[model samples]
Target chain A: MLRALRNHHGEPSVRRPLFSPVNLAKAIGALTVAILAGVLLSGGTFAYMNSTVALPSATIKAGSAALTTTGTPLVLTGLYPGQTQSAAFTINNTGIVPLVLNVSGVAAPAADANSLSAALTIRVDVTTAAAGCSILPGTAGWQGTFAATLPTANAPVSLNSTLAAGATATLCLSASLPPSAPSTVQGGTTKSFSVTIGGVQS
Target chain B: MTRSRILSSARSRIGVAVGLVAFLVLVGSGTAQATWTTLSSAQPATASATTASVLLSDISALNTTYNYTGTTSPLVIAPATLQNTGGAPLTYTLTETNTNATLAAKIAVWIWLQVSGSCGTTTVGTAGTLAAIPALPAGATSGTAGQSTVVCIATQLTGTILASSGSTLTANFTLTGKVGANWQGTDPSSITQSVFQAADVTNITCSTSGHGSNTTATVSWSLPAGATGASIYVGSTLVLPDTSTVSFTATKANVGSATSITIKANYASGVQSAGVVQALDSANGSGCG
Candidate 1:
């Protein structure tokens, strides 16, 4: 239907459609610009209000599995076949957590002549008594030749008991040469070995 | 949309996804980082071995000279001292060589260790021969270096031996040292004495009664006219050393089933009567024979 509208000249004129392509494009462009402007203003407001106050620094320190030993650097002299020599040492768990203990042997150098590491039998036990290692109190926790027990470095065998935090355990060690030990072990043969006591957090 | 724009949008989406995945991985790893650790300490040890050797002192005095014409039975020889002179410990054994088989069969010897007191409770071997002597430990842990053991020797005859007057009987004693392997040095000694006819003790008897796991043997004997002392043995252990007591009671513990008790009389002429043996049973707890 034709519609009439009044112009400035007071003449009757025809009205145009509201959704014409040109008018629609102009509207769309204006909306797009407004949306972009809103996004920028919102980002600027957030940046202005974002104040960081380092919430009183919290310190977190890791727990340690510290271990200490005594009666080391032991020297057993004048050993003979069919004879047993004993020694006692202590392992202390000087940390804040409980620990599981382990024992291992460190072999002597290959250059040692007639090394007794392979021929000597070693036994380790936990003891509460004051007696020598010859009559150790508890059952043996580990028993074998040094060479066989720790064929390589850091190889460990567990002890029979665990140590609580700040606890100390007495360990009795006995070294023996069997009566059947070969003649090579005689004639003042000497050998130097090592024992390693290790602990892991339980 | 333009092809370039479409490709750029796809690339942006991929970058966002990768960043999200990376953030999750970091959070996940943070949870597993709370693992326990191990710490260790070391101790050093050393050992040294040495050869074994022994030394015998008072060897010359170990020889015994007895005149049976005036001497009584169970001739006591001079004591010998054995010392461990090497770095290692040692054990000892004895061997004997007799000049006459007849006299050897009639003769009995007892060797024991006693540093300053009476003969040791344990003898080296059974009477009459030293061939069955076991390796005797000279000291606890065998004989350590510088350790000394005093040995006591005594000889007696088993039966009456008729020999011509002024005749001499001789026997050589050899003591050897041993460790895991036999040692090189040995100690030699000798016994020389006159032979004479010596009478044996008569009417020797043994009776037994059991109490719990122990059995007590009561022995009584009529000593010969010239008897000096007598010894009693419960199994291989000497319960009573030479004594003048005619009747004695010896007790043994843990006699599971049965055990033997032996008694011998000693005379003034280095002679001992034949040993009398009697078996004691654990079931005879309430009765005495």
Candidate 2:
């Protein structure tokens, strides 16, 4: 009797729902889709190689003594006024970018501060010369020299820089100082003003 | 009864198995293959005197070698690429100058950068000088980086520092060509020469009104730093750009003076008398000849 009672407790009587063909197919379809999902989720997650073409932005330095650089050199006294200096420098776009330059800076005399804005802006197409060399456009063969003039003397002197994307140039500046002054200070007081010298690839 | 029980148990197992499979399928279909499409052309792409043709856009699109960390995320934002449809390379060769100058002056070319849009009414945001860049100096070296960028800069621009920029003398410049859209609105804004280094002048305002009505139209030019000549133009109608603006007035004799009259005025790089013209009209829509 005890064994019978234990069996009765283990087994329960319940009616099953009718099996349908539609349900069977659906079950199979679901299982297949699940397998596909697992495979796809991992497959799509991938790392691809990328590329880029870089162009340099313009960058400038206020005070530089680079002699090989091509452009209007900074006038730090010891010369005549309105004089111009020119030489060449090397600008290679080692980077995947192009650099551009716009030259404009005034020669400020001791007595007067020249405005950079008033300075004539000329587009000097810079070319990357032989490795490690660059040439400023328009200055390639400028024979006529210019002199930097000082109205008073001993004025603060400086140079500005402007550059754009991978464009670069390297040349010397032909700068001039005030004419031999009359006031015994013919040597010039070293008057300086904020001036822009050249630009660089950033 | 035993057969029925067996059948029911089998069906239940199948149902559970199928349910799990369906879930898997749904998860399998994901976003990997659904790549985003690049636009045929990027709008709001600007061209300014400074950085006008910088390969910023082209470089940004290079996916072969470089990688991008675009300013905006792809999931939340879509970036429009600035394609140089002009077919020509980016040519930023425009010169800014103050042709006639009595004293020393500084000239700067300001450039604006944009993230993206349909080349619509975007503003010229930042500033940069189109200064001359020299080669690497002695003891100087260079590095090759910046090949990839994620930030989509749709436009570039040129600007001059004027009153708002706190320069004594200023010039007026319009964002022409691609910028005909309209500024103060989604239209692309102009990159102006906001500041000229000259210290003589202060307060230079455009008539605000772009042009005038028929007959004897007035194109006003004023300078606090004072000017000698300010050249004005109506198309190539005026051969040379106006002469001076501080003290002298640039007037056109034949006055169709129609508001539709397209006029453009400019002062070379270092001059303060910059944009001294009315707005652009269909008639004034002539490119620099």
The runs of at least 3 residues in candidate 1 whose Cα sits more than 4 Å from the true structure, single-residue gaps closed, are: A1-55, A78-83, A94-96, A109-115, A128-134, A137-139, A149-154, A183-189, B1-34, B50-53, B62-76, B82-92, B98-149, B155-172, B177-289
Tens digits of per-residue lDDT, candidate 1, B1-289, equal: 5546656665565555555555554554453545343555666677766666666554444344332432334455556667777776676666677576655554556666565565644445444433232333345224657787776665654433434322455666666666765333366776665554354556867776656645576767777676787777666677777888887665544333336666676766655655666566545441133
Q: What is the C-alpha lDDT of each candidate?
A: 0.61, 0.30
True contacts kept of 1: 0.57
Each prediction's RMSD to truth: 21.9, 37.7
Top candidate by lDDT: 1
Model 1 lDDT per residue over A37-88, tens place: 6555555335456677778879899777777878466766666777877777
List where candidate 2 sits over 4 angstroms from the true fold: A1-78, A81-96, A104-168, A177-185, A193-202, B1-289
TM-score of chain A of each: 0.60, 0.26
The DockQ score of candidate 2 comes to 0.02
Report the C-alpha lDDT of model 2 over A31-72, residue by residue, as the tens digit. 686678567666746658777888898787443212123223
Q: Is model 1 an incorrect, acceptable, medium or high docking prediction?
A: incorrect
What TM-score against the true fold does each predicted structure earn?
0.49, 0.16
> Judged by DockQ cut-offs, is candidate 2 incorrect, acceptable, medium or high?
incorrect
